[model samples]
Target: MPSALGEYFQDDDGSLPEIELRFAQPALLVAALEYLFGLPGAYDASRDTACVWNLIHDREEPYRSPQDARRVASGELAAFHRLLRAAQVDGCVLPDLGVFVSGEELILDYRMGPQWGESEIVALLRLLARLRKRGAQVAVPWWGESGERAFADAIAGIDAGRSAAN
Candidate 1:
């Protein structure tokens, strides 16, 4: 059996365990998600995460429309779930402090930075809302200064809305 980390890069079965999607810029996150799930021949389970990372990092243009973005996000989420099922993994292990939904949790690890803009924040919140509707909890590992505070604010906003609803 291949290691979980190794399975991502060398399984050769063309199926991946989990994808550690990374985004250096906010605008790319949606596109990355879409490519993960929509673009044909974009993700190779047997390949390393770097391959997928490179593909997104190397893209030259924005998505054609909001519908296209949504399609990609849906596809990526589906692929993520499939990967988890195939590997019997609980959830994805993210590489950066960004919004990612896994299993029953919407996780935001803010140790990376607080450089995200309003659009990214709104998009992430929308994603988290969808996850919550599907019975997932939202969590942030680091919520202090640096990038943590911003993350905390985001979580607080979500929590407050949830609280108000209850």
Candidate 2:
């Protein structure tokens, strides 16, 4: 994390449970990041796959065709996740956000402006839910609220923090 990263993961609600993906465990790390790249709007698999390959100790990247090789790999998982967080589609209120994992913490921030609506937060939550559904370690550290309510409540808390700051 750097001083400039301050704008990316700005202090949201303390209740906003910071996402943490266990990279030390390669299997979980690969599964989660690949799952994220395949989400509706985030389509950059080849690049992400390369980064994932670097994480696996006993694996080599499967051979790729010239076209597949054309995809410039992301510098790291954090950069790839940032691209996904910023992706948007028509009729979808995908938050203009950023994702970066540092020192085991996968940080998600809803940009420096624009309070996200409940539905938008839920959309993002659903992607995370997918990871959780797969038995991945998607821990909601203080969010004991359960189901989608936890995420909505977290976003609401973040909005309140933003309001207080202004």
Candidate 3:
């Protein structure tokens, strides 16, 4: 179960919060890239790193460009396990490889951040919005029930006037 977004940058103990997003299917990772790329921010997919597994040969090949990753993710390799490092054109507070793909789950762990600011939060929410729009189950295990409710409320209130409301 996930909780609400923490109000403070760090816990009372001075540790940063654990933030991660899980996608139930591997294809969702590709969907996430499309969603992120369409955002106002410019993401440098060229710097992205991808490790794609070949289902037929039972071997994995690593790629340093988004084109190759996208090709494999789009069913070129027929693989279920893929890892992608979605590089941001700006900012260093997030993980290097922002997304991970497993057999049936895609994980984005944000714990590598030195800190979580407004930009990071907005990036996360935007990604979540797309996942919801695509009818996939997005789980933020660190955010408890209240966090989930807050997210639902945010999505429900995504009219032109309150698109980013929490």
Candidate 4:
């Protein structure tokens, strides 16, 4: 549900990479992560803060500006913080876990920062495995006959209302 995804710096400038996923149940996403990673890959309290790619800030270390830090007060952001804390994913009040949404079509997003690597995406596959276990519908936009295109085509026939034209 978090659209307009971007990576603006303290000076408000950026075009970094990001990730998104749709799951049926919100908690199931965490459950999936916990089932696979054992630590709910979203937030590790002992590590960082502000999950959504750690809340878009300067790419450099100490990546917080006065204005950016103020966002910690937003209701949406604060709710996510609370959820992680309650889950005991970490002790940090603002653990920079990944990002997520538990709604009609549960969505998970991640802003791959400057240091992203191929290995990081392996975690996503774990999520796919967990989703299959829970019977949650997945919408992966990949390629080839066995990729995103075929998945979309298959769903488009069964659930035209939910499928995209593309």
lDDT (Cα atoms) of all candidates against the true structure? 0.32, 0.41, 0.47, 0.34
Which stretches in model 3 have alpha-carbon errors above 4 Å?
A: 1-4, 7-29, 37-50, 64-97, 102-105, 112-114, 159-166
Return whichever of 1 and 3 wins on lDDT: 3
Poorest stretch of ten by lDDT in candidate 4 = 1-10
Q: Give the TM-score of candidate 3.
A: 0.53
Worst 10 residues of 3 by lDDT: 1-10
Backbone clash total for model 4 is 6
Please identify which of the two predictions, 3 or 4, would achieve the higher TM-score against the true structure: 3
lDDT of 4 by residue, 16-84 (tens): 222234445445544544432344333333235433333344233321322222333332222131122
Who wins the lDDT comparison?
Answer: 3
Every model's TM-score = 0.29, 0.44, 0.53, 0.35
**Candidate 2 regions off by >4 Å?**
1-17, 43-81, 85-93, 101-105, 140-166
Better by lDDT, candidate 4 or 3? 3
For candidate 3, give the lDDT. 0.47
RMSD of each: 16.3, 10.5, 6.0, 13.3
Per-prediction tally of clashes: 2, 0, 6, 6
- Candidate 1: the clashing residue pairs are 34-72, 37-75
- Write one digit per residue (lDDT tens) for candidate 3, span 66-137: 334345544555433222334343342333334444334345544423345555554455555656666456
